[model samples]
Target: MADPKPALVLHLATGGEPLLFALTTEESGKLAGKLTQLVKAGAVETVTTKDHQEVAINFAHVAAAYLDDLTRKTTVFGMR
Candidate 1:
């Protein structure tokens, strides 16, 4: 087996379920950049989720964002 691919997760300051986007790393980075710009400009934008749901995101309320990789298994002392 191999490690799973990463996903982009966004959380709002209002406190609710985190939004997870199953996008490629490049796509994730691009979205993140867009959010940053929106936040700086104090704007709101709509984005589609993995389930094809349209979500309106208020950048001002975005508490934090990050790329999450489930986990990476490593060995210690040359053992699995």
Candidate 2:
């Protein structure tokens, strides 16, 4: 089966550069909730990407967070 994981897109308040993190839908949802809480608490957190890169993000600067529905490849079974 092909990978169907969508990317978590974080739009910064700066309005120009957006951060992309490859994650499953469920993980993205959970992360979104955590981000919301952190934003309310005014915290800066570090998140590890799928590639194992650590990124420090200030919740206050996060304008928006959503999952990017990337194109998926259809997998055919019982076919060469």
Candidate 3:
């Protein structure tokens, strides 16, 4: 078997503040590209998570990010 693709998460931040999302790598890349384009075109005013916390976007005062190597493992509920 080939090496598995690295897991990813998207982190949205403004002025060093952050909000995180456990999205798949593909989803993370696509959203990052979309955000960049929208930021360039001034199409995105606000970004939010499933929980509805807003992410403030600023092209000049913003940073890009992604989290990788976040592996998953199976667990049983009453097992220590």
Compare the candidates by lDDT and give the number of the best one: 2
Once fitted onto the true fold, the runs of candidate 3 whose alpha carbons sit more than 4 angstroms away are: 1-33, 38-44, 66-80
lDDT, candidate 2, residue 52? 61
> For residues 1-80, could you state the per-residue lDDT of candidate 2 as single tens digits?
65566776777877987777886566666676676677666578777666767778777877776555445554232232
lDDT of each: 0.63, 0.66, 0.44
The ten-residue window of minimal lDDT in model 1 covers 71-80
- Candidate 3 total steric clashes: 0
What tens-digit string does per-residue lDDT give for candidate 3 at 1-80? Answer: 54333432333444444434444455445566566555455453454433545555444433443434334354232332
Taking all chains together, the TM-score of candidate 2 against the true structure is 0.61
Candidate 1, residues 12-70, lDDT tens digits: the string is 78899976766555555667667667767768876655455666767777777665654
Best by TM-score: 2
For residue 78, give model 3's deviation from the true position in Å. 37
- Pairs clashing within candidate 2: none
Q: Give the TM-score of each candidate.
A: 0.52, 0.61, 0.33
Q: Comparing 2 and 3 by TM-score, which wins?
A: 2
Worst 10 residues of 2 by lDDT: 71-80
